[model samples]
Target: MRTIHAPRLLLLLGTSLLVRGGQTLRSGDHERGDVPGWVMITLMSATLVAVILFMAEEALTTMFKAAMDKVNNP
Candidate 1:
């Protein structure tokens, strides 16, 4: 089974909710800002994940393997 980080998931969920709950930008606001809060958060999150994986590929891979081994062998 794959493990999910509950904290990160909840953080993202809460952030999206906050973004949606706030005042919506007008159509003209797109001229000033390229994207909305939620969109920026999503893009930044994906980029952050990619950068983290690139920087810690070996450690993350090892941890994943260890977890998988534990599950499969247990």
Candidate 2:
């Protein structure tokens, strides 16, 4: 003859019941909210472009000045 602990048995039963209830209430229906993913993507792209241009500004200006000096002295 085997005996089960009352508290443990009750806890297991309660957990199983909760899990089953949750599964029954679950649904696949979802709403497409007003949040625009494209806007975030566009903003991120613009930020990257601005950072690249800012980082290269000095080098670009130096090259432009060199080109102008060569043109003027030639």
Candidate 3:
């Protein structure tokens, strides 16, 4: 739904843009290697947060399913 994937998609797009921009900047500058400083940090931070959120969402779904099973069985 809009309330769920919209925010996540926007966040992902923003992070992707930053990552791409950083790569371009670093590549343009021969002194730097791979991604730039700020881009590397930003990508890592976003990736970490996204992974945590994904895990939490999975946990929440599992918990909800368990609760439903208990209720249905009882």
Q: Rank by lDDT, descending? A: 3, 1, 2
Output the number of the lDDT-best candidate: 3
RMSD of each: 9.1, 24.2, 7.5
List the candidates' TM-scores in order: 0.41, 0.41, 0.40
Q: Could you give candidate 3's per-residue lDDT for residues 1-74 as a string of tens digits?
A: 34556357657777787777767786666655545566667666777777777779878899999999999998
Better of 1 and 3 by lDDT: 3
lDDT of 1 at 3: 66
All candidates in order of TM-score, best leading: 2, 1, 3
lDDT of 1 at 48: 78
**Which should have the higher lDDT, number 1 or number 2?**
1
Candidate 1 ranges with C-alpha deviation above 4 Å:
1-42
Q: What is the overall TM-score of model 1 with all chains considered together?
A: 0.41
Candidate 3 or 1, higher TM-score: 1
Candidate 2 versus the native: TM-score? 0.41
Clashing pairs in 1: none
Model 3: lDDT equals 0.72
Candidate 2 C-alpha lDDT tens digits along 1-74:
98655445555655665565455446433353322353445445655666776689799999999999999999
- Indicate the worst ten consecutive residues by lDDT in candidate 2: 27-36
